[model samples]
Target chain A: MLAESLALSAVLFVIGVVGVLIRRNAIIIFMCVELMLNAVNLTFVAFSRVYGATGQVFVVFVMTVAAAEAAVGLAIIIAIFRHRQTVNLQNINLMKG
Target chain B: MQPYYSLYYTFPFYLFGVIAIASALAFVTRKSPVTAALWLVNTMFSLSVLFVLLDAQFIGVMQVLVYAGAIMVVFLFVIMLLNLGHPSEIADQRGRWPTLVAAAIGILMIAEIMVIARGKVASRFQVPPDFAAEQMQQYGAIGTVARPLFNEYLLAFELTSVLLLVAIAGAVVLGRRKDTRAG
Candidate 1:
């Protein structure tokens, strides 16, 4: 059971990594980042199953931090969209200057 | 959790695991951010059920409430508010280098999973559940978590609230705009 759950988490996290690599839309990339975080949370909960509730506590803290991150990240995305009228990462390469 | 594994536990565990992976695949591949966000919600729901299967019931419920309910909703709201549903604008095919890198990472991860699935790591780190069971008997599941959270991790917990306050303030400042063009 432990191995299976960990394997599942790994696959999910890999998918998220691939998403972040491939997706052009900034919002979609952010969503993929959320997916990666969720995968890590799953691994934490799975370990907590064997160790104790300490892993679960970490999961709770992770969720809180993720919420905060989402709020700020989306707000930044909104600001960028307002400035450039698009959310495509390919097009938002202002750092090249 | 049963002392011994049974088909009952194994069945739902695999089911939710499959659901989570599939939904996450769909989430990443979808063109429209709105549709992708919805798929992410499904993935989160399946992950929540898997959490319950792992005997972390409170964490499971929080996964549903906080991730599937709150976070995904915010994602969808932003996707819509920005009018991001135009699937055509998104270039669905990424270049060859990213595809190669992603494949390399995926293969490496699969190899790691195969090593873990060999059952050696599981046997070594598998601590007896006596400590957690004793705590659960005393404080129940949620309380088992809460006790440490409010005691040992109290400072960290308080700091998390402060972090959230800063996040909220930062979001408001970033989102706020001066009057320029009337929408």
Candidate 2:
């Protein structure tokens, strides 16, 4: 069952990676990144159960990091949207060398 | 074999698997940001069930509380606030070579990990002899989880609090009203 959960987590993470790579939409990409974080959370909890309590403790930290990430990422997204009027990644190339 | 065996075991097995895969696909395929957000919620719900099955009861509850509850609500709020334009038709995903290469690498890496996981699973599925409640206590009960959580791991926990504070500060800084005259 642990193995099954880990596999599911990995598959979800892979889907997220693919979505991030293939999609041009910034919002979708952010969602994919969240999916990836969720996958890591799944692994932590799974290991915590199978091995010990440390993984769960780590998961608490991971959740904190994830929440912080979401706040910062969304604020940047909003700022960019205000400037460009669109969230399309390709069009926002002001800093491109 | 007991009549409830399949009900207790196999049902969640297939249900979580299907929900995880289906929601993930829907998340990637949907054009509407709200639709994508909804599917992501489904994925989080399914993963929470997966956590329960793994025996980390506390973590399972937090998975629902934190991921499914707090973070996702924020995601939905942003989606509504942004009022994003229609997702561009997933244009033919040009430059196929790089995608193909990445997918192939992913498949190979997953296969390698699967081979390693198989051995661990085989050992885990075997049942151990039943023990009395006293014996279970000797090995430590759920209290063991909290002991370290509040003690040994307290610093990490405090750091997380600091991390959240910084995040709040950053958000405020980013959104602060700029003095237009300075520019």
Q: Which prediction has the highest DockQ against the true structure?
A: 1
* Fraction of true interface contacts that also occur in model 2: 0.50
Candidates 1 onward: DockQ, in order? 0.74, 0.50
**Candidate 2 at residue A19, lDDT?**
79
- Give the runs in model 2 whose Cα sits over 4 Å from its true position: B1-7, B88-102, B115-142, B177-183
DockQ of the two-chain complex in candidate 2: 0.50
Clashing pairs in 1: none
Q: In the order shown, what is each candidate's alpha-carbon RMSD?
A: 2.9, 4.4
TM-score quality measure for candidate 2: 0.83
- Per-residue lDDT of B1-183 in model 1, one digit per residue for the tens? 646788998899888889999999899888877788889999999998898888788999998999989988888889889888889877664888988888898789778766766755557666776766676778887997898899899999999999999999999989988564355
Which regions of candidate 1 deviate over 4 angstroms? B1-3, B113-126, B180-183
**Per-prediction TM-score, chain A only?**
0.98, 0.94
| lDDT at B83, model 2 | 76
Top-TM-score candidate index: 1
- Write model 2 residue lDDT over A1-97, tens digit each, in one string: 5666678777888888877876667877888998998888888876665466667778778877988988888888887877887777777798886
